[model samples]
Target: MSIHTFQLHDLEIGTLHDLLLDAVSDTKWKIKELRQTFDQTDQAALLEKLSSIEFNKARLETYTELLEQIDSSWCPDE
Candidate 1:
């Protein structure tokens, strides 16, 4: 599998939020597909991958919530 690299600082919060949501969705689908085809030999590795993906998803959710709060609370001076 190939991992894509990005300069996260270049992206706006909303863009990053969208990207993270897409990533979480994709990773979750991959996890579900892998679970369907899992065997005894793949159990450890598969579970590890799923756990990592879940952790990332949780982190993304936290970040998204934080961004939402910031967006809602922030007030720009006119």
Candidate 2:
């Protein structure tokens, strides 16, 4: 087996928070598009895709909430 090496650095909370926000935005857009597609189509596979997209949207929203909480409580005023 081969091994991997990497470097570590301090946690950039602000950057992380921004990334979470972006993820939430992207997921929401996808959910919106999928919903529109779902409304236009009448297929089982499309339903499944919508379900999956909604699930992911929920997960991203949850993460965004958590990040907001952390930013409010832990991050200092800027």
Candidate 3:
């Protein structure tokens, strides 16, 4: 199968393992960022808001990368 075929298959499948992996990856990523923020002496009171903002930022990055990948290979109405 081609890479495009594989990507299409991946997008179609919504397995429990994928959901769990994404959640685990996001949590681990957030914790690492928070640790870095603490090491840099960021304000404590803003951490709650920072976490929310960071979560959105991380997801946006993931989405942008996915779009970029599709842009490189995807052909509309093919």
Candidate 4:
């Protein structure tokens, strides 16, 4: 039998939201690590580069909202 690939639309909203949240969480954790490394390193140029990099706060808020919406949609009726 041949293997098949499916699109993201085939997944439930909850699954997609979970995946995005996990990715965002991982990225944030990595950023923290980078910050720590920058703090420990003595290279001024590297520290300046790290300080100049900007994070997309709006995108983060959007992902958080999406995760919240998915959780609310999946919650069982009380």
Candidate 5:
């Protein structure tokens, strides 16, 4: 699968949040499947991937909130 890259300034908060949520959800589903199959190595890899995804999702949420705050503070009322 090809990964897409985005500039932080270019992404809207909602879009970034949605993308991260989707990634976490997908990782969780794969982890569940690996667990059912009783594949120790695959299960370990999936668990690691799930952990990383969750960490990244938290970071993205923090950044998104900060960006929204900055935008609200700096932008004028229309």
Candidate 6:
């Protein structure tokens, strides 16, 4: 989860695809939470929201790289 280094070659293609789907789900959920929080929040809430947004951004970046790696090696089912 360092957003850079990994040996994904050990994983099954289907499993890797599931991970991709999970990333999609996570980002979607975080985006919704951030949207709601920003619409109405106090200073304290704003700080927490910023932290959450940072985590979401990192996760999004990780998955983006994962996506590119997967895309590079993708193939049709045999």
Which candidate comes out best when scored by TM-score?
A: 6
lDDT tens digits, residue span 1-78, model 4: 121233534656766567567657755765776677777885875564444333333445555666565566675868
lDDT of each: 0.66, 0.60, 0.56, 0.56, 0.64, 0.68
Best by lDDT: 6
Q: Is candidate 4 or candidate 5 better by lDDT?
A: 5
lDDT per residue for candidate 2 within 1-78, as digits (tens), equals 111121123335565566567767766776777777778785875786676667666666655665565667685569
Instruction: Give residue 8's lDDT in candidate 3 (0 to 100).
Output: 33
Task: Give the candidates in order of lDDT, highest first.
Answer: 6, 1, 5, 2, 3, 4
Which residue pairs in candidate 3 collide? Answer: none
Model 5 agreement with the true structure over 1-78: per-residue lDDT tens digits: 334556656777687668767766776775576566555566766677666657656655665565666577666769
Clash number for each model: 0, 0, 0, 0, 0, 0
Cα deviation at 11, candidate 1, in Å, is 7.0
Question: What tens digits encode model 3's per-residue C-alpha lDDT throughout 1-68?
Answer: 11121343466224424643675676676677777777778687348647655665555555545556
Query: Which pairs of residues clash in candidate 2, taking residues 3 or more apart in a chain or in different chains?
Result: none
**Candidate 4, residue 2: lDDT:** 20
Lowest lDDT sum, 10 consecutive residues, model 6, at 1-10
Query: For residues 1-78, what per-residue lDDT tens digits would candidate 6 score against the true structure?
Result: 344445657666676567667757776776677677778766677677667657657765765676688788888799
Score every model by TM-score. 0.49, 0.47, 0.42, 0.44, 0.49, 0.57
After superposition, candidate 1 runs with Cα above 4 Å error: 1-11, 36-41, 74-78
